[model samples]
Target: MVGNPDEPHCVSHLHPETAMDQIIPFDPERMIWGSAPALIYLEIAVRVGVIWIWTIVLLRWVGGRSISQMSVVEFLLVIALGSAVGDPMFQADVPLLYGMLTILLVVLADKAVDHAFRYWTTAKRLVDGRPTEILREGHLSHAGLDKKGIGPTEVMEMLRRAGVRNLGQVEYAYMEPSGTVSTFLYDQPRPGLTIVPPLELRRLPAPDALSGACCTSCGLVRATADGTCAECGATEVTRAERLESREISSA
Candidate 1:
């Protein structure tokens, strides 16, 4: 019997005996081209193009900070947009209209959050944590590092990238809400622990050769006679290295 061209075909109805074998039949045409008409490809492209442009406009409205220095809220917005924009691109079942609505709602929610952050200090603090002091007067703040779950070595690496050769070069350093480190330098840098060669590679001064010492753990400077760091109580100390005038000139 002839079947209607518009109606879906069922292998089970045609051949009940061979239905089990046809359950997952290999059809290359169906797999590659899908069951939709060829024109659907053009529709998908149009949907993608429109959505891409709309997303760009919405992101621009949200401001560049969303991409550059993302806070927790901005990070979540990125994740939501990724899922919203991707599925409708290829899935024939997902309508472009629904995807567009989803994106609109997501961006609106982000804007609402920004509005709340602008007016409410408590909301801003809760979502994006306040900046924590990592260094004060060239000394590492162990308490602050512990609060932020960062180590002294990691803080030193950040300072090094910011053009700081030693702890004394930094008057203060803060770990911002965006996870970036900000360093403030002193007018005349004092003698402190060197971080260029890294702690592991640098050799410690012998007991007889020691003139001045700095804590190996937190980079706090100590008197030559002092056997322990007053700031961190670390007994292991290395020779304090001074930041040269030539280094300042080069910087």
Candidate 2:
């Protein structure tokens, strides 16, 4: 929009000559949506048919995992496919064969990446990344937490979403590549480190009552209060080991 005479400052003053930038070139020919030749239309039809059927079959073979828990590669594959197919579908300037070639290339690249990931550890790490261990032995992994930029509250929120009350109840919690956390709750409770804080402890066994002690620094519970914390290594001992309620992690 052009600036008003009285409200001149309302306009962008970056360009000295506002009119020069404001002037847009319009082509009369651009208004025309010309039709293509029969051969070109046939090419588009064949390309679309092949790519559509190929995409459906490939996606079906890949299964629901691609949609449900998409890895980085899977997500990229989807986007590239969309971009490749979309341009050819509507853009007449983009040749039908060119679009088909683009789709095929994307699909082949996806397969290649998949094959590499299956066989090569380095490639797998590059594509899917190493799964971050957020919880281990009932204790939150400090390095894991720092790497993911998440804290006790965030971990507790994940546990809550997973329908867990205590970290002692979980043996392992992994931050997967697809951004979903996989938590494994133990059948029996044990004295281990917990990510759940004191204020928000839920229906959990009391630390002192059970075979565990709470860490003075990070609140990770262990088997005993006398020893250093497995999580923070704090020596200060106060084992108020009652299980608390849960709070959604603000982080």
Report lDDT per candidate.
Answer: 0.73, 0.61
RMSD of each: 10.7, 12.3
lDDT of 1 by residue, 1-251 (tens): 99999998777657455544543434544434556676776665566456544664565444323344777667767877898889768755455655676677678778877999999999777667788888988789999887777788888888878888888888899988777888999899877777876777767664324547778788787676367678777888777777898987886
Specify the poorest-scoring 10-residue window by lDDT in model 2: 25-34
Write one digit per residue (lDDT tens) for candidate 2, span 23-127.
333422221222345475466457655654466455544433245478766766787788988986765455566667667867877787788878888987655
User: In model 1, which runs have C-alpha deviations exceeding 4 angstroms?
Assistant: 1-68, 206-211, 224-228
Residue pairs whose backbone atoms clash in candidate 2: 138-193, 200-244, 200-245, 200-246, 201-244, 201-245, 202-244, 207-241
TM-score of every candidate relative to the true structure = 0.68, 0.54
- Quote the positional error of residue 60 for candidate 2 in Å: 25
Model 2 CA lDDT for position 186? 64
* Stretches of model 2 off by over 4 angstroms after superposition: 1-68, 191-219, 222-251
Each candidate's number of clashing pairs is 0, 8
Question: Residue 250 CA error for candidate 2 (Å)?
Answer: 27
